[model samples]
Target: MKRTTGQLAVVIAALVAGSATAQDMSKIVNTPHNMANLDVWGVVIPENQVCLPCHTPHNARAVEDGASQILWNHALTEQTFEMYTTAAGHQGGQPEGTSKLCLSCHDGATAIDDFGGNEDTFDNVMIPADRLSNMGTDLRDDHPIGIEYPPPDLTGYNDKSTFTGVKVVTINGVDRVECASCHTAHDNSYGKFLRQTMEGSALCVECHDK
Candidate 1:
């Protein structure tokens, strides 16, 4: 069946609108990750450049051992975290890989505006301690980040090879869970930048057999 030009035009318009909506939903500016838009934190972002705070095209900062450089521009955290040891015998160690990158701002020690090697702008503007985002250096109370997945001896975890929603970072020949495993830095469509929704503990059960 041949369609009229008007029908084709309507179809094109619908496609364009859908594309735009998806773009808007994935934009970092629409999420709290956009440092330039966080005026409530009193952070005076030197410019409107959104990606510059965490990423850069050149002269990027070097990441710690066991982590690959991701054109990172933000300062790395130096705090030593006290990791958690689960009752099931799983133990977490010092954070590495993308998890450490996240802690650069979330540890409540590094300033949110202390990127691009700039020293004069908001040198002390750290994430507020009261904010839930600030996980602080003591990670004993939070979910283990740098721990081995599908624990060598645990029973509650699902097989890592069969996971579809979350990912684990392989650092120094060990596949371990990192901050990026649970959260997507650029998208907040599901809220809290979670890669999946938490309804019915869906996200939690993605890795845990429980």
Candidate 2:
């Protein structure tokens, strides 16, 4: 793959930015993200390596446009999405940051065995269409991702700092909500890898005043 000077610069920038964040490997063995434990995809990762399906220590694959890097080992999704838009004119745009990484498997576009440069012989083996985890590419029905958080008016939304469980990702100096905001990939104690329990709408109210 030939990369222009600008593209190389972007990749370098992403590498630097990605290296700053810590990788949380705790509690993933019990989660669905533990591909080796599932064995449904027919990919035999040596020694039941739970992290290899999504991450690698060296030579991780670069995502589309080199937007962000996180030792990403899985094949990225190329599905064009119908983004979410709110009645108040808030646009979710395309998936960004960790959201894109999550979609690598969840979108049902990239095969489950399509990591580590392996041929995708099990292309049919993907997240089941009926499952809620298989969000597919049509994101219009889901909560908005890649959207600026704490709307300019701050109407019906709590201050970003008030969020104790969920988090917002900063993209290009602007704080935005991504999948990681609500879902902590390494931890699933709350179920669904949610940063906090949704019981009594607790997670929803973390950022939403309603």
Candidate 3:
């Protein structure tokens, strides 16, 4: 049976829409699960050695500072990070735990291949020296994290509940924003691994008044 031109147009539209859908995996190559494929995490691990870059099955690297721990396989960065500050003369600095874990890979101080007891799995596997994604030891320009925000009910936000309602990963009993608060490490359901849509600053406005 021959389909009308209008029918073909509709079918094509649907196909295009489906291709752009959030969960479309082909459009998602840089998600954390596929870190080996990223320039920041540039390396070619064996198919079986994927997670070995950041995780391990036995005797994982122990988190040295904070109480929070993971199966962390990568070596932590050595630099003392200059954290974000509020208007009150640079208070509210210092990332807690999970954020530090991300910095292990993104802070541009640690090597992408610097994991598994600092084993050299690949040559020159560190992230490039300079890039926006390569957030250096200085974090003054970035959004504030590791700082306490008003809990449960806050009057500054349009929806005070929205402020506290969104994901807030705590470390060592402190309610602070870590990298994972806005990001999904293994999932790209939202672009750039954001936990929710940032459209119209949808994610920001949820917690801010503006």
- Highest TM-score against the true fold, candidate: 1
Give the candidates in order of TM-score, highest first.
1, 2, 3
Q: Indicate the worst ten consecutive residues by lDDT in candidate 2.
A: 18-27
lDDT over C-alpha atoms for residue 33 of model 3: 58
Which residue segments of model 3 deviate by more than 4 Å?
Answer: 1-14, 17-33, 39-42, 65-67, 151-165
Residue 182 lDDT, candidate 1, scale 0-100: 89
Global lDDT of model 1: 0.84
Spell out the clash pairs found in candidate 1.
none
Report the C-alpha lDDT of model 3 over 76-180, residue by residue, as the tens digit: 777788876666543455555778788887788677777775464555455566666788888888887776554334455453346532576666676656677
CA lDDT of every candidate: 0.84, 0.80, 0.67
Show pairs that collide, candidate 3: none
Distance (Å) between predicted and true CA of 52, model 1?
Answer: 0.7
Q: Report the lDDT tens digits of candidate 2 across residue range 96-190.
A: 77788889888977777778756645444688788888888889899988888888855898987788899888877888888988998888777
Write model 1 residue lDDT over 106-139, tens digit each, in one string.
9999888888867665547888988999989999
How many pairs collide in each candidate, listed in order?
0, 0, 0
Winner by lDDT: 1
Error of 2 at 12 (Å): 55
